[model samples]
Target: MITLDHNTAQRIVDRAMQVIGHSVNVMTPDGVIIASGDPLRVGELHHGARHVALRGESLAVDASNAEQFTGVRHGVNVPITVGQHIVAVVGISGEPAKVLQFADLVKVTAELMLEQTALLELGQHRRRQTEDTLLALINGRAVPQSWLDRIGFDLAQPRLALIIEPAQLPGPDDFVILLMRQLELSDKSLLLAQVAPQRLLVLAPIKPASTTALRSMTEQALSLLQSSLSANVHMAVVIAAGQYIEGSLQGCYESALATMASGRRESPHSSVHCYSDDPVTILWESLRPSWQQQELLRPLQTLRAHPRHLLYVRTLQAFFDANGDVKQCAAVLHLHRNTVRYRLKGVEQLTGLSPFRLPELLHLYLALKSDDLSTKQ
Candidate 1:
């Protein structure tokens, strides 16, 4: 049962007055005048409205019988009902015969507006509940089994979580609808919700199929999203490795976040990234901070203070990437072999580690990689 409060009742009264050209009063089921064209009567009780609400019918109060009832007026009062329940009463003030014609019309309008408001509120409430459930799942919060059961979500099933970070924010409903349609998810197997202002999280059930089939489906989905959303959105997908269950979501979310971070660093041109595509970089990123204070990185940190020091690091990276071949490193850097050698010597002098020695070369390479990761962080 829905009850009419003062705010909604006042809106109904104002709107009814616009259409009917008569003073209107909106009353609660208990006959308290919550809203009225006559502001003085707003907090008063109306006997005629109470009679109509209790009897579940329209009641006409004429001037002849107006003095018999408390707060009675010369008007027609009709019950405002939602389904079979009388939620409120609406009265049109004037001669009974003149106002009777507008009483039913105004009552219907108010009831319809209240019904629409109630439905909108109910939808918002459900959306909030859905977001709460998804947040709990992604964050690894413990929820009661009965609560999941009540919501009709099964946690034991295998599902892959994907995080979508859009460049421009879209409404949750539009985002969900467009994503579901583009991904060809037409049933309950897909759960998509906006967990933040610019981020949407999705959990899709993994069908019983080979790994190749799942990869194909994921590729197709990414293609569709990229094409549908244009170039304005970047998506990161992380597939669960082990048996897909409720407990694996946190790891998957972390993997997805790491994948996105790595993608933005390594492959900014590509709009999508998968966890399996670059596991080494992601794992190394998790361990990079611990190596921040390593002695090998100290030299690079010191070199970074020099204005033109990045040139030495790039030359060293190219040298290592070319496997210590001077000609190949020079070709990769598009610099003369002599120039590459001079930069390598500069790197050795600044870092106290020669690029030619195997042990020193390994140390410089690791240091360069750690420096890159730190800059990104």
Candidate 2:
């Protein structure tokens, strides 16, 4: 049982040493050397480990490229990975042929330890019902104080929890947990917990008044996650952006809900969409499909039959984007204001609604969204 403030990597390496009886070095999830038995090289780079990791290869290197190892006496670089992403590397200061088993052994052990530790930490972030329960668990008893000690969790920092679910899945619970903990352990977020089964909560420590930067960091976390997940699964990735609504976890649940809604509204081609960007449109898709085909795209199909109607819809969308300013719409369309008005008149004549009518506007918006559905993309 590795307790609080315990060095997880060091513990595994100790187990590795008992079998091999040789000096070994362990890197963090980010490629920095966290611990090394050799006193002379405690804080050196494991470039060889990094190289193997970057290449996703498990080979043996020797004195020829010793400089790459930063002058470590001798060692074999074994890449430590959770899935495909290289989380860390284990370097044993011995000959490959001699310590090949040891190096491989350490690699396996480190990988296993990393996987288990990640799951344990992931369980600490489950926040399904709302923010209060999640924060209480992440900051309180839902997590073991020992695990918190392992990662050195301090309440002073600002943390935001983001939830990511598969575009095509019901993937394993462990995978989600591992992913959150992997990102959290990367020194990126404060602490991550597995709340609400498929969900994860991340705690981000921010400056006293640095809400914007913290928010930016949370949004940026998506790319990192995208890189780490597998492409084999034919699914779209849904991310809930974390918001600090109240306490440290203020708006995380809200952001997650928005993100999930956007994901459901997406056409699988969309990689990311914020709820704030399209709340109503997103919600409309998830409101339990009305079996009525008319509810599907009647307005859009009607507009499609009218050749001029498609052109009109496009122009109107752009015009509305200009905030109903006719002069700006004319300039954008390379038309005189008179031509713009003529087209608007034509639209009113054909659609049975004035261009500015609220009902007509709502109908047009739905038509635009549903347009792509009938035609296979």
* lDDT for residue 261 in candidate 1, whole number 0-100: 69
Window of ten residues with lowest summed lDDT in model 1: 236-245
What tens-digit string does per-residue lDDT give for candidate 2 at 1-377?
A: 22212288778668888888988887653456777776566556666766776787765767676665665557677777775677777878777668777766787887788788877665453323224444565443365565445556654555555566655567675766566545644554434556567665555554443645544555555554545555652154556654444453434555556566555555455655555455455445434344532564654555567878767876777667776777899999888998888787777676565667777866666555555433432
Cα error of candidate 2 at position 239, Å: 4.7
Residue 327, model 2: Cα distance from true site in angstroms = 2.0
Model 2 misplacement above 4 A: 1-161, 165-178, 186-272, 291-296, 373-377
Give the deviation of candidate 2 from the true structure as CA RMSD.
15.9
Q: What do the candidate models score in CA lDDT, each in turn?
A: 0.72, 0.61
**What TM-score does prediction 1 earn?**
0.70
- Cα TM-score per model: 0.70, 0.43
Model 1 per-residue lDDT tens digits across residues 312-367: 87788788779899999999888999999998888888888889898888778777
**Cα miss at 130, model 1 (Å)?**
1.4
